[model samples]
Target: MIVPICSCYGQTEDGILSKHEKWEFVLEDTGDVLQIAIPLAAGLTTLFKKDYKGSKQFALSYATSLVVTHSLKRIIRKERPEDRNLFDAFPSGHTTSAFSGASFIQRRYGWKYGKWAYLGAAIVGVSRMEGPDGWHDIWDVLAGAAVGIGSTYLFTTPYEKQPVQVGFYSNGNDTYILSLKYEF
Candidate 1:
């Protein structure tokens, strides 16, 4: 993705500096959508499935993350790359929201759901760095990822804590994989 976009934009450097696919912008937009949609989806799904506790947990996670992300944005006051603003760029809110939803799905369900969700979240973060106007640095994306993952972890710990996990997956096409995870 970066190869083609960088080549076209004349940015052959290895560092983040902007210009990628328009679809990358769409990915960020999807992150924006997920911020709202994930909580709604989780809450409603749990409610309809008669899992009241899950619904409450999901709501709590979303609210706390939203508050924390915004508060940090105000406190940090970092500047954007394109001079769009003098502050509010320490962390990418879109990335935070995307990771929040992705992490929530992973923590609540399993890696099967998490793998794809996290990929989407990562794409959202990358999209933020794909254009100058987007104006999100690598650190911004990292902080957002951390915040999103931390919030979800904090909220989901009580409900579903996986101390350790070992699993395997098969694509039914002679492709098989083994995985392991340990959570403190």
Candidate 2:
């Protein structure tokens, strides 16, 4: 149900790609770098912090993004923008992988890092678009971003709601301490 909405924004028929430009290859490599770096960073960070839940969340998010994105690409089996490739084109895997990493940083680490994380994410898609090979259309890139971010956002939850919460409240001269929770 939610999938359609995420994929709706950037799709189009008769899509085209841009001509090659200088220094654009760096953008493509940026996506490739993210695919390797995100998991390594998360693992090291989690180990240093001894945060078992955070590690679990990163692993789940990463795995879910790859599996879902690849599965859809195979199922849709569309073509590349220049038609050099005749399959695996509905969504961009690079874009998806990049977004997955960015979303993880944003969700777990904080938005401070999110700013850079998302810039890399967006760059991956744009780089593909700038290529002479015409690897993907804007719709493909957008759909890839949607899937990668969506899967993580859906699987990873806020840490604010703890299993047990303790708080204190004051009402005029009356002060009180309370704890409450409803887990689903």
Candidate 3:
């Protein structure tokens, strides 16, 4: 049946993968899942925190990254490193998706919170290049990351409540002092 035939396509000799191939598949699959998971998590975090403005910024950044990444993929018409026949490979979409969410979290929240997400995004980029398919080159991965981060940078601002202000107070008399203020 067609289903059986299609299923067989993912297998190697004897419909089984070798140890090396298994690891590669794991990396590829992880990247594939994280690409979607990262963004979805970011959006959900915004909702959970009741950050409506951050939700809008995240949406714009994510949408822009997708649009720009896909548009360049089509316009450049670059071929994949592994697959010669497939031409939509100028930018790695997986990397873009992962970075979009990571950068959004970093910009809208803080690096302390976003560092793990960024690491995940970096793994996505590496997987795109070193995984079983090796679908993209370094340039593609870098460009994807740039597009993702750049879009977020353009639209996202630091969480409004996180600023610390240093104030200098002075009176007509010799009353001068430095005060640090933080709003919780």
Candidate 4:
């Protein structure tokens, strides 16, 4: 299965290179997407109420995945399809990083946000294939994604805290008091 997928991606890479030079810009800009996803994922961590540990877990998982993927790239040192570059392309570093950040966002938020993050990750993966280097096969992207998602789940503690609600009420005299309650 992996071999066939890699072959298909190689074929697709040819078509992308032949058809679209403009895609190079898109490929380059995917770095900015990763920049944004990381911070946004961190911000979403606060929404889990008392799950500070979970927040740390999410952040750490993302960082660890990035390091692991990049290190593996150096070790494998597979040549890019274009041969213009000699850098390893066996498991896409860009795709791994993007998915790591995206998975962090998705785990902290809900599917609505997860869907958008995943879509952005897809774009990054496609951009890698479209780049001038023409590195990475479909299996590479898939493996990178699995590594990212798996690490995120493995590191993050499950959300087990009960929800707490805080409300503000104002009296006629313009005085306000906040009331707090725990649910479940």
Candidate 5:
């Protein structure tokens, strides 16, 4: 997917900072789309499963992340890495959105499914620090991720409920029926 975008910008060394300008551009655009897509996708998944509770949980987490991220950005008034004149750069909003969705997926579904979302979220973080035109520093990205994950942790729970399982266990000549329920 990235190969075509990289080739379009000609050579990477031609960039102002000798960084892959094409990669930076592609990453920035991709990250922008992903920030929205991830949350939408999570929402769709919940709808497909008919899990309204999970949907509400994810929405709350996402909303909390947005509020917290924007509040911090406004309060800190930190300058962007690329331009000191711009102030709302203390927390990368793109990273916050991406991580919020990713963490919600992990919290609701499970790691087996959420790992891919996390990988995409990590890419969004990288995009924020990719090139001369990068918008944020590591601190901003880290804080955004922390806020996202923290918010989700406060609201989300697993989609699958562990029900009591009644089964028979046999060892040698002994047989027993047991009921089990696993707790988080």
Candidate 6:
């Protein structure tokens, strides 16, 4: 239902492909490689910080979500708008992967990094729209976000203690600092 509506409303082939060509400069295979690698690194960092279970949970969730989405896409085999390929576009896999990473970061670091994390996810959504092999509408991106965030939160262990006082401060010398005081 949602997929069909999105597909109907999305930009035509020329519009979408034009954007794709522009984004190709920055969002090519190398970019995807970085996207995949960075999140795994962040998850490992969480593990080293003694959140071993949480890290493992995030890693597994991310991987599982990607696999499931990709498999479903393969089975559906919906054709891309440009006819460049045949894979389901009901949900954007790259967007899902981006959201999964962002969710992991938010869970491990709290809301301090939330803005940037979500910004990255948004970029992925846009990239998906721009790419030849991409999703057509907001629904697809939303669906991907749901799967990514849901999997991460459901699989991770709850924080032992929430941060009591989390805030930021700026000095007169144009310097800023963030402080987190936790109570366990």
TM-score of 1: 0.67
True lDDT of residue 154, candidate 1: 82
**Mind giving the per-residue lDDT tens digits that candidate 5 earns over 16-130?**
3333446667777888888888888888999998999998998899999999999999999998875447899978899999999999998899998799999999988998888
Model 3 lDDT at residue 60: 93
Query: Relative to the unseen true structure, what is the C-alpha lDDT of residue 76 in candidate 6, on a scale of 0 to 100?
Result: 68
> Against the true structure, what is each candidate's TM-score?
0.67, 0.69, 0.78, 0.66, 0.77, 0.63
- lDDT for every model? 0.73, 0.72, 0.87, 0.67, 0.84, 0.67
Candidate 6 lDDT score at position 117: 75
lDDT by residue (103-139, candidate 2, tens digit) is: 8777877888777878878877787787435578999
Global CA lDDT of candidate 1, please?
Answer: 0.73
Sorted by lDDT, highest first, which candidate order results? 3, 5, 1, 2, 4, 6
Error in Å for residue 11 of model 3: 4.8
lDDT of 4 at 101: 67
- Every model: Cα RMSD to truth: 13.6, 12.8, 9.1, 8.0, 9.2, 12.0
Ordering by TM-score: 3, 5, 2, 1, 4, 6
Q: Name the regions of candidate 2 deviating beyond 4 angstroms.
A: 1-21, 159-184
After superposing candidate 5, which stretches have Cα over 4 Å from the reference? 1-20, 161-184
Flag regions of model 4 displaced more than 4 Å: 1-20, 30-51, 158-161, 164-180
The digit string of per-residue lDDT tens for model 6 on 1-184 reads 4332222122443565232244343554433654565466558767777877676777788887788778767776666555656557756687788788878777767767756776777777776665544444676677777777877777765445445889899887989999898776
Could you tell me the lDDT of residue 96 within candidate 1? Answer: 83
Residue-level lDDT of model 4, residues 95-176, one tens digit each, is 7777776776677556667787778887777766656455667877777788778777777644555589889998879798
